[model samples]
Target chain A: MIRNLQVAPDHYLLELRLPAEFPCPEPGQFMMVRLRGRDEPFLSRPFSVHNFRMHRGSVSLEILYRVVGKGTLLFSRQSKGTILGILGPLGRPFRISSICPTVVLLSGGIGVAPLAYLAHRCRGRNAGGKRTSIIVYAGARNAQSIVGIKHFEAVDLRICTDDGSRGFHGPVTALFERDLCSYDPEKTMIYACGPPAMIGSLARILEATSFSCQVSMEERMACGVGACLGCVTAVKDNGGRIRYERVCREGPVFDIRDLAGLKTDPC
Target chain B: MNASGTFGFGEEFAPFVDLNELGALVVKGLSWEPRQGNPPPRIIETVGGMLNAIGLENPGARAFIEEKLPFLRQYDVAVIANIFGETLDEYPRVAEALSRAGGIKAIEVNISCPNVKKGGIAFGADPDIAAEVTRQVKTATDMPVIVKLTPNVADITDVARSVEAAGADAVSLINTLTGMAIDVESRTPQIQNVTGGLSGPAIRPVALRMVWQTVKRVSIPVIGVGGIMRAEDALEFLIAGAKAVQIGTANFVNPQITLEVIAGIEGYLIRHRMDDIRDLIGSLIEPDSLEHPHEP
Candidate 1:
């Protein structure tokens, strides 16, 4: 581990030195992390790559997290020299296409980590030199909860707070809805990751407008690899039949239309 | 052995550890038809363990034979297919399907899964029911059948002896103990199924005790499984008369645990100047049997 920085109240940005040979993780892909040699917390927790960068023969990635539970609480207390176990670059990554020249990254609170990486990657590739326009809509409980927006260097950043203590005085969904008419739905793609409630609200809005969107889901996972089927999400096949697909395998990122029943209570 | 349910088809751990190093790769519990399993939150972590109500979800027997079995055929590890059923009739059919698949070295009958509503622990909790399921599965396949027994019973040995009487080649025990956790704020159960099977280091002591008792009762080989996270844990079971040990929840903690455990056991044998693992198996020296019990 290289650095563990407290970026905000109860939130942190953990930087770890990666082997140069490590496979670079795509924005939406995640890694399972746990305290090395500790058996009390039997399973590793999954975290999306907050930021991935290389500089002067060194490669490191930053993971953004909040101390919400025992696993994250213990992770927050680790020092710079603590060695942690990690299983990486697992699950399907967000697929960016040329058809959608305009990409909208929608995130809620700490869910902004992967979206920040998505924006950074798109700007780096210049969307394969197609002049892609990038926009980010970050929502949180208050100003203190919003995080990881600084890495979104060259994109349009919009912030909203539920408590009306930040940029826009409402949920991020409402702000995005008001500006929905400005972009052409045919050329725009929306990517979202957040609390289930926020995603539910966005799903409702997108259903009415019929814009193409994909959602990154979070589930309590035992094995980040596909071995344990502990992290499955409800989804509809092409036949519209509902089945559980491993979020750690087929997704953490899935097209909104493929979700079964659009139920807010993720199983 | 990578315990059933914790290890997928063994393909997931291929990148981290060589499959040839494992004693056997026990795939997830397979049903005649694909089961969606219980609703979530199906899993929750406790102090030193976790409760899971996965309810035996899988791609079904046909899917395993057609899609999953091919990937496992490349490996040199012994493949043990763990089969279960919602009904007694489903048992033989699924066992026959896997047996016909050709690559399977053995079949592990799962009558002990605690999460399901019927045909899992229900069959396992009763000696007669467990024996019936074991007999049916055994008759359907020419391969060796090892019956997995549940811990959520008055006496685990009753079920073990029953299965042995009915022609089980070996027996693996104990499956997760029935447990539940509640969220104080919501006043709701942490598991969607109200109760789940508890596994990990928390259940190791109880599991080891059961294995010792069952080992004494059944003449057939006894395979110990339940929260075996390290080499010492595996050795403890072997000393208690278990022929072999299976790694369960520890695979979730570390994918390379099987290799580590295999190496650790070898290292201990070398240090003790033992030539064979059979000398270590069931080699426990009771205090009363020793001349000076207190002397180390």
Candidate 2:
């Protein structure tokens, strides 16, 4: 059972009880949730474990939805006692360099989930007072999808909106490009997760730059675990050739250089 | 086996099954070492069947022996460790590791993995390589080695005879046939691994034909596999000259299928007064047996 369901209007903060036998999920790992009482969609949908408290047998998932489909609308209305069929924390996680003193977390809307975990992990580590600062450039269509702003008050946060309804009147990538010019590329590593447009735009922005980058992605996945390679990406292999990789297994997190195109697995 | 990715080990299916009733528990294919496997979209579903390109993911021989073996110990089923590898050397090493584990009753060497791009041509493709690899693994372990032939080959009989000559104790057929599916709107392949191994009801006819071909070519016992969804399907394998039968894609649909199939086979046997199952082995319309009805 997830201990907390921190509702922030548009998004539901779901906490899941991680079974003891479950492999400890890393920073970028995601889980598949089987929505009950819904028959239209036949399979489970994958979600990243936004934050984990493995010692306490719980994982916090940030679900940012607009209550559209039966799956989402049904999930949003469910009571706390709901017992869902779920399997995870599937897929590979992001790798944070212990030596990096500064890092940039790029996200748009709910893409913040996995990055939030990365930031928390950096903060979780009992480093000898190592100064690690995470700068987030998060965006959404408007304020609703970006509702979890209050949670990161202590961390540096920058918000963006598409229609000038919020912080910057553009996608998160635009602001990221402007700020990244001054940020030390040698010392700062970028971690991003968001829609394909944002991720693709950021990839274009950072193509010539020296900063190492990884992006957490989303696709219409049935089995959130690697068993179903429904969420695969085209990664450029060693010989400059592209091959499919399951996001649920190889990564929700992957080096930007390895990605051939900013595309998700077909639904 | 678990048809590559459809099933893991026998654990998930146990709740709905009395595993001991299974003639042989063929676990999923394992490699010499651990594999990260191909990236997501490894599996896809179709009407009445499914396809997968799990890339034969397993926890290498070491972890399989160390961590997973314990759960399978109490079961009375014949545990066949299906092994696969990239090269010839890896096959023996995997067989030796599984043999050393002790509980695994036999080793089923899967030679037809098409996902890999290098090294050996799929084991069932070339009779010489198939025979060579079979020789290496059979010599490496004391456990009976069952060479699992693939349907993708043109002449499965050549490889079947080759492996039998190479000292394989028995053989199993038809591993999943290679196939694919696509997503129309975006015009992209549905599986992350663009192509996947096709299994389930769709491949039953193809699988049966290949098993029959191998059955006639080899002297050893044949274990039939592929799209076996019902008791009748298992009966079909027995009637087609298989010594034993394995449930692959059917386990993904109904976990209790192994027991369900056994019950169905026993019920069929009772109706026919076929008291001993061993007598049914290779009893498929024996051309000479029909002329002299009661003669073996």
In the range B89-195, model 1's lDDT, one tens digit per residue, is: 99999999899988999999999988888899999999999999999998999999999999999999999999999999999999999999999988999888989
Query: Which portions of model 2 show Cα errors greater than 4 Å?
Result: A1-267, B1-5, B11-21, B45-51, B74-76, B119-121, B181-194, B263-296
User: How does chain A of every candidate compare to the true chain A by TM-score?
Assistant: 0.94, 0.84
Docking class of 1: medium
Query: Residue by residue across A1-267, what tens digits does model 2's lDDT show?
Result: 343343455577766554566666677887767654333343566677676655555444444444434456556766666777666666778887766667788887778777777777775443324677778888877765575454454568888988878788888888888887778776677898887777777777888988899888766554454434446677898799777676766777889888876643310
User: All models, DockQ values?
Assistant: 0.73, 0.14
Alpha carbon lDDT of each predicted model: 0.89, 0.72
Q: How do the residues B115-136 of candidate 2 rate in per-residue lDDT, one tens digit apiece?
A: 6654323666899999999999
Q: Please state the i-RMS of candidate 2.
A: 5.2
